[model samples]
Target chain A: MGHHHPGSVSPLRTLTAAVRHHRDRNVGPVKTVKLPRRKLDFFASVLQRFGELHAPVARNGHFVFQRVRRWSEARLEYTRTELPPKKYFLPPRETLFRFTPGKGYVPESEDLDRRIVLLGVHACDIYSLNILDLVFNGKYPDPYYQTRRRNIALIGVDCIPDQRCFCRSMRADTVEQGFDLFFYDIGDYYLTLVGTALGDDMVLAAGELFESVTPDDVAEYKRRSQERHQRFQLDVEIRDLPEIFEMEYGSEIWEELGAKCLSCGSCSMVCPTCYCYDVADETQLGSTAGRRVRTWDSCLFATHAAVAGGENFRHSRASRVKFRFYHKQRGFVAEYGRPSCVGCGRCSAVCPVGIDIIEVINRLRGVEYAETEHAATR
Target chain B: MQATKPTVGIFGLTGCAGDQLVILNCEDELLSLVDVVDIRDFLMAASGGDEFSTLDIAFVEGAVMTRRDEEKLQRIRRRAKALVAIGTCALQGGVPAMADGLDWPSAVRDVYGPEGDGFDALPARALHECVEVDFSLPGCPIEKHEFLGAVADLLNGNPPQLPTYAVCTECKMRECDCLLVDQGRFCHGPLTRAGCRARCPSYAVPCVGCRGPVPDPNLGSAMDVYTSKGWSPEEVVQRLRTFGPLPTPVPAGEAA
Candidate 1:
């Protein structure tokens, strides 16, 4: 269960194949190239011609995706950023439109056309963006999200999985598409995979900086990929887990977790796929005009399921907690043919009370667990 | 403008009056607020309105710590169609209420000495204990934007929507590293209500729960998180009680 390979019989398999097929069909064949370690800075400098550059930078003793004036400021080797790259697409707060008594509503177009080159993203993050694309680009598409998607260029980089990372188990440890360029470290050189026409343009613009990948480079890339695969310390079984969630609908574990759950909404906020939001209108003082706005919302919040006339659909903490898990693991499977979680483990790292996803899933699968072993301290 | 403007009053009781001060601190929006709403009675900023006239909305701050405070609150509730309780003092019986079970006479004597004999102060209680509160905006001193937003909602004939999630929501949204999880620090962000925008955590300072507890605070697990970090149960409870009473979680057997 812990050592499943990519394209295994799991919920993520179909979606992963779909994404790869879509990219291969649209962008011709993926062009594999190599750039020397020393020329990385030179390559990044050339990327500035396309758009403003952003990369992971140290902030308050943690990493965050920030705009960098120079390539030296970007921490390409950072483990994880506090917030996912989703902040670029679905912002924390955004004004949809402004309304006036006589003029009606005017849509806001601020920052929609700004181009950005987001650098050093991990595979899980890029995959999460693909999931978000499915949601935001569906039947009722969001113009704001679609515009941002078009403006921002994703440049993904390979990462070493930390103790919290479970991307390998979720099949998100490696990405084949949804990024302009994906770089894998192979000692002295980076084996880059170009997935889009824009990526080809970036390489062509760089001239001699990028070199063609030889047979030895391909062998070295395979060796490093295998090494990275073995480094994942955490794992969760995804096969038949959605059915298990359905069977455990009446389990006492939900009540116990609810009693222990803080309902802080931290997990959802840090998550890459939890994209629920709440919309509201703000009226200006001494005027009939106002602006409609939306902010990130979580199903764990008491008010998330609340309605008018003092009625709450999920009034109990146990029910709300159950709803969050069921929605991600079961409900999403029915709708999108896959679970929504990318298994990035940001939720595990950010939960103040240590409500880990891996632990919960393992418990639901009837694995025995002791209190001291699963304590919140670790 | 006077024909359509709502008559509003601001009142204070026993706390630091910091919540009212936050309103006064809204310098840029203060004139705009006065332009829209008729400032009938605000002793801190203006005092020319008819104090006896009926008020459409009344903003009350501070806790009820004296007999006079109770009477004033009852009067304000009677004359106002909508009464909003602002700040942790009025909503959750802040700092002053921390001495509820302690010896009051000796405690007062320790501070005021001989002058304390004539000081008749009742135990600190929240405004809801003395009168019906229409709405509550909780913070040590209510956040300026929250106060302004609530007022704007009331003026627009809509119920004010306050965030029900914990401070960790905003803290994560601001991309602040979790003080409790990342570092071995004591932060009340998990149990404390949001709307302070994770201000303390953004500066790398741990939250002290000045906004009081969230509606569904998991005290058991919060204690577990603290204890696992080497804090004793007594230490955790004492820290939680610093801002207000730690709400007791309903027993699992009794919970819905």
Candidate 2:
């Protein structure tokens, strides 16, 4: 229902429109190309020239984004990675600067500009990256994140909807921008969308590898898109979700969820968009020299709100859980005209306990039967 | 340099001296450590010490399991400027205190026969139960880096900062897949204190909560989570008791 605007455009719709405008204004008209499915393996070698090629690979019966020497090592059809491509930009831990008492502070700039080509990114992930760009590219831009973003190239690929996926409900199933190149598998070929001049250059470099799309190919694309859309078993109505979240601020459901929450922060770490970090000055054992390090932080942690005076703003676990939801679904919408969550289902899948976003939202809306039924079968 | 350095002492009570061993295991840092601090008392590492002298900092490991242990802890607390309880035994009653609620006299009799009656033993309890503990560095065996960090902080005249968050924070940072969610493993990482850097989980092993409980843990809900995976409540409690005494379960709907 949220996907279909009946009378007037919503704030998120306006944001999406603005995103489209921004993309078109910067890249001119969208150029479509085709690459034979068999040629993809050979194209991986060509991609290496641009940067260190990283793609999803199997690890311990799960998928992880790792550097691959050969295309055979990459698992393009992976449902999700243990950690998102955001790690390549924000990193789990990074040194911001090194300081000495008398010598002053020296900025850490090592490997800030390492070129990386992230292949097989999902649409929701690319959309999440765009959201990250909004946060990091503000007035006081983070030089670290910005530099990494500039150096890394994204090549998104279409994904098959899993039981956990709810990206369609979040309006992130298809991305209009934020990726240099996007590939959609269609039988024997990949319908590629060149999103930028850099992407166009890649196509140019590939030369004979790419071909023009045909009318039959366009019809096939429409058919596959419909099939993909219908395959999404999980859906959450985002219409007036921010308002619902505001009304349910004192809902007892938070207590129940918080009681069940382990607060391990696995969901936040695996998330494509969660970007909160904590900074600390880690001094050497015997020297005055220390490096100011930044590490990933989660609102769910007990110490997230702890201050110098030993007063915790969100001391209660229930309040911390509520804070995470309110920020992603309510506060973020107020500021960015869109929700921060892309519904990538990483939080749901990675949670040790069954604290699913879809189930939680459905429960809040008082339509819990569908998700409950699906969960029972799962 | 030794005269200019701060005086420190390391003492053990009754539990296994694993925590002190972790300090000695700091092979690389130990040489530099002696140069920076005046380690006046360390029975395991040195021959003699002036027990009457005041210390700038005192690191006490193990729990108060005997009347003598309690008396010794009180003496250490009185002479030290600041006392830090090291390891789970000194913070929470670790594996040693798991027998606290059991029939200790009969249990000891079974282990040592009639000779056990001669052995005088009080209920095993953490050092804080008998004496004031200024700080605590909790782990089954205190982590080597954590001990080194505490010493480093003491050398700079700063209070040692320890992780207040749970083991899950470090586990996630390491990007280890959720063993509990994915494989139905009963990991206590969510409730356990951090600072071991998630050593077990990184190797595809579940945490046994050797670091003790984090602040405001949801105990009842954690039980429910484990029970749902076919583990009985008693079994869950049994697994938890391997490291430390079980805390009272915080019920659902209660703010934790």
TM-scores for all candidates: the values are 0.92, 0.91
- lDDT tens digits by residue: candidate 1, B31-131: 89988899899998877757787899999999998999999999999999999999999998999888766788988988889899789788789999999
lDDT for each residue of candidate 2 in A23-130, tens digit (9 for 90 to 100): 321353279989999999878888988999999998888888889997898998899888888999888878777789998777676777578989999999999998
Runs with alpha carbons beyond 4 Å of true place in candidate 2: A1-30, A371-378, B250-256
- Candidate lDDT scores, in order, read 0.84, 0.82
How far off is residue A12 in model 2, in Å? Answer: 34
Highest DockQ: give the candidate number: 1
Q: What is the lDDT of residue B90 in candidate 1?
A: 96
lDDT of residue A245 for candidate 2: 89
Poorest stretch of ten by lDDT in candidate 2 chain B = B247-256
DockQ of 1: 0.67
- Writing each residue's lDDT as its tens digit, candidate 2 over B1-256 gives 4677788899999878999999999998888888877889999887778788888889999888888998899999999999999998899878878876789999889888999888978668988788888888889899987788778776676777677778887887777877787878889888888888899999999999899888767778887778789888778878878766876454454534
